[model samples]
Target: YAMTAAHKTLPLGTYVRVHNLENNRSLVVRINDRGPFVRGRIIDLSYTGAKDIGIVGPGTARVEVVALGRRDTSAAGSATTYIQDDYYSGNFTFQVGAFLDRENAERQKRELAKKYKNAHITVYDRGDKIFYRVRVGRFTTLEEAVQQEEILIQDGFPDAILVAE
Candidate 1:
């Protein structure tokens, strides 16, 4: 219920100003999660935030989002300027495969868990269909995840790809 939002490219914890062009309404929101995975949508505002910006009734609206930087709690809650490089530093994992059948995904996860830590299945629902994605490992740094991606690819899962969790 907090005034948080989801954005595909913004770094988590970054603050942004969402301006609804239709109503000329605006609100400040924190990027606390990643999503709006639906194609063509750039941001996903929380219920309270969308209501504040007059976007709840219509569901979606043309909006302009401006990054307002991340809050620096150590410096008296001041905000630090946004940096492009900050996006790469976060939770990451390698997706070994995706399956339409949950059992298939589970089987892959079980096999991966034998040789890897954090092997699990993440479900993605796209309205018409659901996909079970098997992923392995958890790394805070992209470099570390990429290193494992190579190993996973070489081990057998050639299609394994690094994904930010």
Candidate 2:
């Protein structure tokens, strides 16, 4: 299937324009999966899209990507953003809450599910303990995240901190 590739960080359904710098070929693809988790890799091209860009044989090529926008298609699908193209502090997000307990993290995630887009819990190890962080929304520009962070703080997420993801 030559639909599209996965994005580890960007929200699914995001519109991304991938430009093959070598061939000067470009394609706009909608993200519908997750991947390219390996370091130094950004997006994984599908066989169809790969064929279009003439890179199926070479397997990999240097490319530049530009995020066009995103449309939420979750079960509660109603949120969207036309995120302007900004290069400053790319992919900044806000961590509204963090808990040492997974249950507490899940609880927050549920509460946010009703009110925010891309609300989810990301588990990670810090020092000797595991922390579950409840994050909300992925923004390309830091200013956008900061605006939401302030709203979250006013709404009682006092610990909301902006993170460059």
Q: Clashes per prediction?
A: 0, 0
lDDT of every model, 2 decimals:
0.83, 0.77
Candidate 2 structure quality by residue, lDDT tens digits, 34-98: 56645467888888888888779898899998888754444354555455434466887767777
TM-scores of the candidates in the order shown: 0.53, 0.47
lDDT of 1 by residue, 12-112 (tens): 88899899999898988999986775656889999999999998899999999988778655564454544434556788887778899999999988988
- How far residue 97's Cα lies from its native spot in candidate 2, in Å, is 20
Provide the lDDT at 163 for model 2.
58
Q: What is the lDDT of residue 137 in candidate 1?
A: 92
